[model samples]
Target chain A: MTPDDPKDPAGQHETVPGTSPGASPQGGVVPDSRGEFTPVRTDTPVADPGLPAHQWRPTDVDPKLEKRAERQVAGMFVAAQVFVVLFVVSYFVFDIGGDGDAILGLGASTVTLGLCLGIALLLIGVGIIQWARKLMGDHEISEMRHPARSSDEDRTATLEALRVGTEESGIARRPLIRNTLLGSVGLLGVPAVVLLRDLGPTPGEVATEQPYEGAGLANTVWADGMRVVRDVIGTPIRAADLEIGDLVNATAAALYETNEEGELVLEGTERLIANSKAPVIVVRMEPDEIEDVDGRENWTVDGIIAYSKICTHVGCPISLYERTTHHVLCPCHQSTFDLADGANVVFGPAARALPQLALAVDDEGYLVAQSDFDEPVGPSFWERG
Target chain B: MRLLNRTAGRLSRHRRRPVAGLLVLLLGLFATGTFYAAFAPAQAETTASDAAQVEEGRELFLIGCAFCHGTNGEGVLTESGTQYGPALAGVGAAAVDFQVGTGRMPLVQPGQQAPRKPVIYSQDEIDALGAFVASLGPGPAVPEESEYSVEGLSAEEQEEAVVRGGEIFRTNCTACHNFDGAGGAMPRGGYAPSLKGVEPKYIYEALLTGPQSMPTFSNGNLTPEDKADVIAYLQESEEQPTYGGFGLGSMGPVAEGLFAWVVGIGGLVGFAIWIAAHSTRSLKQKGTTE
Candidate 1:
């Protein structure tokens, strides 16, 4: 075999001295596979240019300037620490919900916390930039072009190279520095773990009281005789008003309850949680249109029925109703329920029927609940024993 | 089984008349009864308190509504088989009130839909028209007078009403009419109109009649008090202050998030760019001095 092809072992062995395999020999000739020799030209049109001349920074040239630059960088870091302190102080200084703490319509607490935290971050970033530009090593370095693939020899010697590097670093002898570095890095993870507490109390911890005291997962604010009020404006619903083919979004009247002082009985998060589970849709259809589902016959007040709005499929509030078919479709997953037939799942991914609320009208003509839902409302997982 | 037994007993008792003749007689009676029930003129006028109002409404209907709607308020069906306007006979005063009060009636010309506009008649004339339309049939009536405004309630009740109204508005109406009552796009070409400056009575009537493609919120579905709460919320919302600085049109989180990203991030990026430019210029000067 002629000695030109790099892939050919016999050709590599027969290559001319001082010339690379696959490269032309000094006579500008390369051998062919059939033992014939062919002339080749080896020339490059362009030459590689080296990197530009290095310029010295002010800190690199003068000792006084170098010391001043170091002070300025340290000052920025110190200012960052001061801003962090300000952030902590602001957390306690400003009132979150109380009166006279708002600044330009935003909560004073929120504004101060955000501003301090942001400034601290900005200072830290600027300090790091200053340190790198004015004080840290700035010597220019370059590496020669080489194949990305390592040779077998270099691959085998990697462990030995690591050992030599470690020895040169003197980390094994510097016990104080090494342990302190490890301690600081490990301690940084504590704040991240501590912040996880803000995700809210566990389901078990949330109380299950009625009349607006509990978490939504276990119970709602629906009480015996609590009028089913229209959502938004706490107006009581009268049974005489609804016509056939009408659907109304309704909620428990307890949401509008106030104490003697006129403050809400269920305040803040409790109100929000109770309201989430309390949403129900009241729909009216012809009495003949509804199929009698055993005991549910008494649940309707003159052909009007109420059911929880939460879709059993992943808990989206469903209200899209097709009056002719008595089908209420969940827009999120297209889960359809036949409201006339006891709110049964008619189509799509819902695995369970919507929980129906038993209805009764008070002497005042307002629609009221006979009792709480017989079964827990929402996703089937909550109903699991 | 009981029905079958009764039929057999009737057959044995009826020996003089043949079963076929008896069957024909029963069928004729059933057909006549159904036809009468289906086509009978609405008998709601007997329930109306004011006959004079109904009489005035009839006169108004003759002058204005009868051109498209027949003199009997049965609506015209062209020779081409298209209904020029819908029958107003059984739609009642509630429908009449909503259509006329909202100024969607006296349609300039029939097309895909009628839009709300300035009313062509005075309040008295409108009421008369409503009474006339209502007198023709047994349909929903104009509800008794309601104090829909929050001014009627105690201070505490007013606050609670506003809160509840806000909750209701956000939950139900916000899907089509946005959080601030600025309406949004509906499915197809229609839109839920903005609640701004709309009369509370018109809102109540719209809920009952379900003008156009909107689903009806009947008296039983949304009680009178509930309708009042909705009205209260709509009225209160227009006056409510935007406490958290910029409202961004109360278009909800999507629009707010977009604005935050654009202006907030853009400003930050511009500052960073300015800092970088200043730093580089200073570095060049230092390099020249060295």
Candidate 2:
């Protein structure tokens, strides 16, 4: 504490008559902790340089230049106004249909109105920016900063108030109420968990009516002796019809089967449920090209092999077949499978080789599935195990 | 004339008995046959130009393609067992037209694929080459213009054709050619060529032949009408000006997402730089730097 004044308890400054704490920036004698004069060597290598001299913008120096800048900013604002009016005019001038050529594909009114509004907004923004950059203030002002921390007394008072509030609330003392509140808050999540169940039936239940050997993701509608029909046409494919390099997209003939009155065997939702599972790509390559696997030797008929089109990585259909190489690639991800081999995964994200369908020919020489796919088709699930 | 006169002199020298005369006639026929063999090709070139197209094509093929494709269009193989050129037999005139007409053949150099280039052969010469290859085996014939053209369909009919074609193309072509026919990558270091601006005739022939790594969609799999419908769909989609600016190769999300990351973020960084440049600190630094 300075001996000169009792109010200055912390001794922030020397008892020097005229100089304040920061008034003397360089070497100056002041009272230290011992109350003795101490010469402080506070010399800086570089002089403390303050804010640079503000350069005058052309608008600031010359009235003529300032007027021109004002005019330019005004011009942009006027252009924005004109576009706003044009936007309204175009909305009336062009129709959504009929003469749809406002701007290739997008309806005339839609493109024009959108373009005009977008431009108007952009112009107004640009005009405001230009006005600020040129016509408005170019001076760079520094905002003085002070310590953000509160005073020691104020900090102590706040902490004391918080402690009192907490003590009165009795949150720590009331364990029974706290535990029950936590329990109720946690149980609130039950409704949300139950709501998600109705999103759809289990992926397998759709085909429950028919007691097919495989259930849900495990099986498709393909059965023994089922003809593999061409995709969109639903016509049965003859093995002879496929050329050496031909990759035919086929579905099970059961999807197209008719009953006594000729109603489709699987209609609407049943067909939709079964359709994705049933698609198989039948590719014909030379017999010598195929890499033989045990038990799969009879699966191919005359160098023709059938594989599930769905990718093993995700369920994207795999049909990009290269004839000479006998590779089929999935477009979703570049998962390449060698169809000539046992549909082995040759490249990319697919973990397993595509499921192979045992293929045979019917009495009429039409290609047919000997049995269902050997395993499940799509991506792996928790229940797959 | 001298050859004819010599043959006649040889005929006269033979004996003139019943059995001997028959033998003499055979000798004369042999001489005439030798004379014709020596001069007929030249005469065929000079007199019957229309019939000599295949012959002319053979000569051109020998000069341009024989090194890799052999003298008889029988393919050659490398020591590695990879094809230098596959045999042109049973590949048809349509295959020849697609390969050569599109300038994918007479390969610049052997590689994984034959990329499209400027057509070197004239239309007439291409026809002759096609004819020559067709003569090698009974392959598909070149399609008539009417078969591939969709100009005959009414607007409504074309719309219906497009819908049908879209389904067929999605089922068959979308795996490689992509949903928009912008094309996608294939196995190995191969690519499915973009179908944009491709002629309907070449599209037809390509579907028939399969070309390079592409699988053939045989006539049995997709009928001629179905093939035409695919062409119709492609043409219709191409004619409808792209809805969004810059299709980004129509590679779907991959390219569009890449563009967003590059350009969208790039624009923000550029604005940041401008703001930094105009800041009070940088402006002061700029004054001192000068």
Give lDDT: candidate 2, residue B2: 100
Candidate 2 structure quality by residue, lDDT tens digits, A50-140: 7878776656666676699799999999999999999999888877554544466556766787899999997898788778877777677
Give per-model TM-scores: 0.54, 0.73
Give the count of colliding residue pairs in each prediction.
12, 1
* Error in Å for residue A134 of model 2: 3.9
- Candidate 2 lDDT over B75-152, as tens digits, reads 999999989888888999999999999999889998777899999999898988888888899988899988777779
Best by TM-score: 2
Candidate 1 ranges beyond 4 A from true positions: A1-47, A50-241, A248-280, A286-308, A320-385, B1-87, B106-116, B139-146, B150-152, B163-185, B213-217, B265-290
lDDT of 1 by residue, A152-250 (tens): 577669978989988998789899989999999999999988888668764444434344354546677787898998776577888887777687888
Predicted model with the maximum lDDT: 2
Error of 2 at A140 (Å): 4.6
